[model samples]
Target: MTPQQEPPPFLGTWARVYWGVVLYLAAVIGVLMLFTASFRL
Candidate 1:
């Protein structure tokens, strides 16, 4: 008989959520940087 593999845990879900938040923050920071650079004389 073949051994059965266990399903992945909730950590994967948490990791995805964490990654999404990080990407969102990075996007916001990038936009702010662009805005500030545009305002510079």
Candidate 2:
């Protein structure tokens, strides 16, 4: 027998939510790097 799992509230499923978090972090880091470079120039 298999256990039934519930989907997350936003983003459809848990996996999508995880990927969304990853992408958000990457975007934040990219923006931070851009700011750092602009300030250093």
Q: What TM-score would every model get versus the actual structure?
A: 0.61, 0.77
RMSD of 2: 2.9
Check candidate 2 and list the clashing pairs. Answer: none
Question: Tens-digit lDDT track for model 2 on 1-41?
Answer: 33457777898988999999999999999999998899884
**lDDT of candidate model 2 versus the reference:** 0.89
Considering every candidate listed, which one attains the maximal TM-score?
Answer: 2
Q: What is the Cα-based lDDT of residue 14 in candidate 2?
A: 85
> Model 2, which residues run further than 4 Å from truth?
1-4
Count clashing pairs, candidate 1: 0
Q: Residue 41 error for model 1, in Å?
A: 3.4
- Count of residue pairs whose backbone atoms collide, per candidate: 0, 0
Among all windows of ten consecutive residues in candidate 1, which has the lowest summed lDDT?
Answer: 1-10
